[model samples]
Target: MSVSLDPVNIADKLSLIDELWTQRKIAGLNDYEIKLAKLKGEFVWHTHPETDELFVVVSGRLTIRLREGDVVLGPGELYVVPRGVEHCPVAEEETAVMLVEPVGTLNTGDTGGPMTRAAEPL
Candidate 1:
C-alpha cells in the first residue's frame, strides 16, 4: 500500500529544529531524519558506522574536512559522506544546513568527541 502525507512547511519547522539543533524523524519506515544545524567555527572529527550522512547547505557555505581533503558546499548544494569515513564540518561564518540521516545515528561517531551526543527533536 501507498501513503500520502500532507505538505509540511519546512521553513516553519526549520525554526524549531534550529532552536534545538536536533534531529526530527520524517519517515519512520525509511529511517529518515530532517535536521537544521547552525554551525560556526569547526566541529569534531567523527564518523558513522552504519549510515551515510547527507548535508545540504541552506543559507551559507559549509566545509567538510575528510582525511583525504576538504570539500566546500555552497547554498543549495548537497553532499553525502559515506559511512565509516572520518569527517569534520566547519564554517567560518554562521551557516545554516539541513541534514538527512538514518534514525539513531549519532551526530558524532566513534570519535566520541564533545559534540558526539546532542539533543534531538522529538
Candidate 2:
C-alpha cells in the first residue's frame, strides 16, 4: 500500500460551479477523507446512516437545515452533522468548505441522487 499527503491551499482547489457544489478531495487517512467543496446553492436533504460529517467553512456562508432548526456557518466556523440526522446544506453564494467524513461515505448520504459522487483528488 501507498499513502501520501501534502499541505493544501484550500481555496485553490475549489472549482467554478454554475448550479451546485463541487467537491475536491485533498487528503485521507486510514478511515476518513478530507474534501473541499465550492458551494453556491441548496443541496438535497439526506443523512449518513453510518458516520457523522464534519464541515469547516473556509469562506462565504453556509447553512445546514434540520427538522428542528438550522445551523448557520460562516468563514472560520465549523459544524458536525450527526449520523442519520436528515439535513440539507445551503449556500447563498460561492462558499468554500472542507468536509471530513469516513472513507467511502457518499456525498449524498442516504440519498443517491444525481449529485452523489465519489470524491476525486484535487
TM per candidate: 0.80, 0.88
- Tell me the lDDT of model 2 at 120: 72
Q: Give the Å error, residue 91, model 2.
A: 0.4
By TM-score, the best candidate is 2
Candidate 1 regions exceeding 4 Å error are 1-6, 17-29
| Candidate lDDT values, in order | 0.75, 0.84
Best by lDDT: 2
lDDT of 1 at 67: 98
Which lDDT tens digits does candidate 1 get at residues 15-111?
Answer: 6654323345433436566766777788888889888889998887899999999999999999999998899998998777778876677777777
- Poorly placed runs, candidate 2 (over 4 Å): 1-6, 15-19
Candidate 2 lDDT, tens digit per residue, 1-122?
A: 66445666665666432234656678877688998888888999999999999999988999999999999999999999989999999999878889999888888998998899887776
Residue pairs with backbone atoms closer than 3 Å in model 2 (clashes): none
Tell how far residue 7 is off in model 2, in angstroms. 2.2
